[model samples]
Target: MESALLLAPKLVSNPSREFRSNVRQFQSSFCGKSIAIVEFTRTDAYTNHKSISKITSLFSLGKKKVKTIKRETVIPDPDYRIPIVLLGFAGGLVYGDNLLAAAPVGLLGLLLLFQTTRVKFVFDDEALEVKVGEELDESGENVFVGGKNRWKYSSFVNWELWWPNFPILVYFKETQTKPEGQIHFFPVIFNGKQLYDVMVERAGPSKTSGPN
Candidate 1:
């Protein structure tokens, strides 16, 4: 009876069988967890790499694609040769004894006589260029000076035209320090309507107010 009771407890316990079942469950769960972790890591890495490649490609394309296209026009400056020459001659007459004073007056006369009477307007998609100079080209036409200034299209705000009284005035947006914006005045000689139309088309339409 004592031997049977001891044997009964051993059969009920079954330690080896329970231990084997726990080991199998642990191995199956660990394998599944490791596979899921590997898949998540690989997916994350691929997505990050693809996004980086696309951004790099966009920057490369922007750098290569930028280009500039330009056109040139010559507008004659208002003829003031008569007044300039007269003023210079008068100055020389009044200061005849002073070579220093007379020299400047004489030089002024000569300079004005030879100065280019036209302003060369160069237009690019980006900016407007103004060049003032008197150099002849191979074809015997007056060319502009080497140096030039540009007014960007982005700075422009609005323009006004007065038809027959036609001096088109263009205004730019003001900054904090400058209460009044910069103003550009251009006198139209050829065809006011046509020139205004072209300017509006190229400059991308703005508030055009008044023949006033």
Candidate 2:
């Protein structure tokens, strides 16, 4: 379904010499198709995960020895959805150099696209790894690619979690100098129940009074 929708644009006749325009059209089609795929895959993954979890629980009912099972939760970074939609909408507005409509749309779309770059959060026993532009493996493990921002359990201090609209502010005591201290702001959007608990457990106690 998504492939057909994406390729459907190729059938539209373009009698213009502007190669950039054609590229933009192609990209817009790609983004639109991606949104469709993300929505479908998200729903499918959730359903499959639930079914698999039930089966696993039933199979593991009568285990002999006691063991500690590490929990893993995969949360899709949904920041890209809005930007991709905006860009696709902008591409729709572009009708052969119609700057009046296209210019603002294109600029706004560019900004949104910048914000929409893929990001995923992987939480495990040792560290909280942030994987950008990568997904999970077949066994539901984070595919450790090149770009990964990992925060070890002992990396930050002053674990302050704020209200409804706030980011997790943690101080990197390791980076603190005699004059000033370094603070890192992690957006709360990537946070979940398990992830939060793991972070707190790893971080232990807050050393500093505040982000100061």
Candidate 3:
């Protein structure tokens, strides 16, 4: 369904240059869906005309339900994360005319400084780690990773990825109401209950108790 939507512009005789415009038009309504859960289900060809009609956004939680999920949002030295990204995602500045090529790197350096630094969060089959800056050397880092929670180790508990520049700011404390409660403000990925259910299927007996 998503592939068809992306290909629709070409079918409409629109040039590749106009693809962004087409996507922007489709993103209009869905862009405002704050705290909405997006899922891919069967595409409704008829009701789905607005370029992006197939994907669904579920704003199903009540105010109180949503309120229970609050937590602090912070990242330590967020600038460190920037350098790594600038090395990877640049498009124009490096290839523009000679005059622009000579452009002072100060601006780019500052921009990347903001990108590469932040509180890090990683959840894999083994452990869930958190810390300030990238702990490339996991041997002697500060509380870089919070030990195993009652939560299981399932990859099915996928997280939402954000365009870090305009990150989806998730303000929730670790354990929020759980014992290991700690405040945070940084770019991290998260998957809610339904995802946890999927994780439980794979992680086996990892569930502990939460204050809910």
Candidate 4:
């Protein structure tokens, strides 16, 4: 009876072992497939991310870079010839014993000298403007009837510099101030050569010759 019992247990154990072995084989194959699928999904996502980044970089490189330009001042250094001449004339009048005439002339000379120290002629790409002081402050309203201090070169009707060799005055007519064209005159208190050159370059050549 003992031997028969032992034989029965051995037969049952054999079937259980085979069943376990088959289950293990199925689990191992399923796990291996799942691992392969996960790896492929990760690789695809990584490749897609890399491609997107590369395309974004290329687009950034294709964009145009904008350049910033600064406004240029035409008269960096002021000229005092007009004021000096006036002062010299006033001195001559004083020497001639004309106190009344010398008084006014001397005041005018002083006024012009003060103006020269403060006034600046600034030029940008399109227009000529009057700025004041080292800070280049706005010159405010025009002393003339109708217009701002700023004037477009396109509006100029005609311009001239007197006595090209010794420019003492600058005259320009522009329709910007009035449709009939208002005449404007300024003493050449700034660098005459630079002023003439810039005027010709921007406002075009005048009927009068420029300083040599």
Candidate 5:
């Protein structure tokens, strides 16, 4: 006898008051009323995680006021048949019921705390499953995938260590230039040196040109 399989699409809920409330609370406390989102540049000839962190420290981290930055990036598929990609930044999923804001914030003390490290990676193709690694552990890396190409988890050492670096309060200019604030996260799938090596190798090469 053959068995029949019932296939149903995964369900996603609408935005919620709880999230809006959190957003309100976040906005009031965080200082994010405008467009956030830092420009995550692939490590340049003169920069590395440490240098980037240094630059970040100078801006929002300076005055000690937090900002809530939200960002959305849409990846277009050349095949049009492939669904357009939508990536919601930290604290966003909560609003849309896609993820719980409470869990992350309770532990990390506001998503903005890990701005450089906070990211919501999204894969829209029905055929794509994000390859989803073996097991997810506790770290600030998963949510952002910062190391792989250019993402949140890419620049963090440990969420704990990265926390203080996030700007508590940030201000945005109407012009929409530069990141005012960001989201934060901890380990979700991969961990430790494995994560580090992946980023470094993909980063191509160190700016230092030396002997063969």
Candidate 6:
């Protein structure tokens, strides 16, 4: 009876040991699967991130950057000589008892003087443009019926600065304004030296020689 009791206890202990071993095996397998799933998720995320970065880099490389050319002021300072001379002439006319002539001359002088304060000449790499005010804003449409305030240097057929020693007037003909070519005349109300220099440089040498 004692031996039988001992044998029964051993049988019960063996089954309990087997069940514990099985539970340990199942836990180890589940833990390994969980680790593998976590590793795969991280690797996939890393791969996707790398791919996105490469695509972004390729797009950046493909896009071309545009170059912007800056416009420069050719006539930085204004010349009031033309307007002052006109006004002086008008005053002389008035003194000479020529009221009829004086009225028009005085009006013209006033207009020119006002223009001298507002008008500006600006030059870009390709063209010459007229601007207004200290801020260099567009001068709007030309006073002439069919004319623009801008002209390309390439389109200039010829240009001249009259009385170079004491520049009073500037004249230029350009095909851009008219295919047949258009003649333009403007008073020298800007820095004559700078104007002549820029014109020679951009539009090529004028037919007439400038100041020595």
Per-residue alpha-carbon lDDT of candidate 2 for residues 80-186, written as tens digits (9 for 90 to 100) = 44455556777777756565787787787676565345555566666656655555432233243222355555455455554323333223342222124335554
Cα lDDT listed for each candidate: 0.44, 0.46, 0.37, 0.72, 0.27, 0.74
What would the per-residue lDDT of candidate 1 be over residues 1-212, giving only the tens digit for each residue? Answer: 99999988875675332211111111224323311111111113333332111111111111344566654443334434443654577576767766656666676555544442543444456665555545422222223312224556556655565443544333333122133544555433224445455556556665646422
lDDT tens digits, residue span 40-127, model 3: 2333345543332233344433244333442233222233343444433343455654345434443564554554453344434443
Instruction: Compare the candidates by lDDT and give the number of the best one.
Output: 6
Q: Once superposed on the true structure, which residue ranges of model 2 sit more than 4 Å away at CA?
A: 1-68, 73-117, 136-148, 166-182, 187-198, 201-210
When summed lDDT is taken over every stretch of 10 residues in candidate 5, the lowest stretch is 77-86
Runs of candidate 6 with Cα error greater than 4 angstroms are: 1-72, 145-147, 208-212
Candidate 3 stretches greater than 4 Å from native: 1-120, 131-135, 139-165, 176-180, 188-212
Model 1 vs truth, CA RMSD = 18.8
Q: Write the per-residue lDDT of candidate 6 for residues 1-212, one digit (tens) a residue.
A: 99999888775665223211111111124323311111111113333432111111111222456899765656657889888988999999999999999998899889989999998888888899888998989877788836669999999988999878888888888888789888888888888988888998889999854322
RMSD of 5: 37.0
Q: Sort the predicted structures by TM-score, highest score first.
A: 4, 6, 2, 1, 3, 5
For every model shown, the clashing-pair count is 0, 0, 23, 0, 19, 0
Worst 10 residues of 3 by lDDT: 17-26
lDDT of 5 at 65: 65
lDDT of predicted model 3: 0.37
Tens digit of per-residue lDDT, candidate 5, span 153-201: 2322222211123312211111111144333333322222332333334
Weakest lDDT window of 10 consecutive positions for candidate 1 = 52-61
Worst 10 residues of 2 by lDDT: 50-59
TM-score of each: 0.34, 0.35, 0.23, 0.63, 0.17, 0.62
Off by over 4 Å in 5: 1-178, 203-212
Candidate 1 residue spans exceeding 4 A from truth: 1-117, 133-148, 164-180, 189-194, 210-212
